[model samples]
Target: MKPSIEYLQDAIEKLGVENDSKAAAALKISKQAICSYRSGERIMDDFTCIMVAKTLGIDGMEVIAAAQMEREKNEERREIWADFRKKFGVKAGIAGLAAALTLGSLAPSKANASNLELGAISCLESPVKLYIMSNLAWGGFSSKQQKCW
Candidate 1:
């Protein structure tokens, strides 16, 4: 991998520069410019790269290559993320909506009535009640009837 600005900063500190201000002073640049370079917010020019490398006693090409690698990696990651969103965004949304609908259907609706009894006794017509009544003729001829029971 190419050397990042952070790597260069570390090299500078190893060479006895205390902080960014000191490093910038060594390179004859503003502290803000050094901060921007360190943060990768601004690109370092070839001349500046060489100056920084010379100050830190390192090869300038190494510093430039590292910065270029970082920039390229950042661009590649952005492209990959954009492609992923384009490929899956609509499908993911539709899947989420379908899951919500299925779960909603599985849950009970407040508007529908339930057959289970509450505290008070209530009469509700049922097929089992009709069948029981038809099967049982409770009278003197109950035993003589066919075995509907």
Candidate 2:
């Protein structure tokens, strides 16, 4: 897996930002936060990764995959800690395992909106699909008569 730093650098370059501080300004975040994301000290949330992808004119799934890599590494560390706690007692081990499982379950799953099946584009979120349909429904014309397509 390519490091998060590579993705961050590519985004920063694509956005024509001079450095992390400038990139942070463009994204309305702190430079330190950007640095942390690059260093894998913090994982980027889904919406933030999507916004970065949008800003960089790249696919959001790529950013999501990179962030998932970081999250998986962190999850491994958590599993190791849980295993170490197993030596204390069966109850403690079960509790640790349960906590790990709960945290893992909180990660985002694929959206399953039934009415949003647009063939190959079904992978996008339902709201985004709905937004596209709503905008395109007027035959490339907006409510204000603006061209939307």
Best candidate (score: TM-score): 2
Poorest lDDT segment (10 consecutive residues) of candidate 1: 119-128
Instruction: Count clashes in each candidate, considering only residues at least 3 apart in sequence or on different chains.
Output: 2, 0
For residues 17-48, write the lDDT of model 1, one tens digit per residue.
66887777777778887778877788776666
TM-score, structure 2 vs. true: 0.44
Segments in model 1 whose C-alpha atoms lie over 4 Å from true places: 72-149
- Model 1, residue 25: distance off in Å is 1.1
> What shift in Å separates residue 105 of candidate 2 from its native position after superposition?
46
Worst 10 residues of 2 by lDDT: 80-89
Evaluate candidate 1 by giving its C-alpha RMSD to the native, one decimal: 26.1
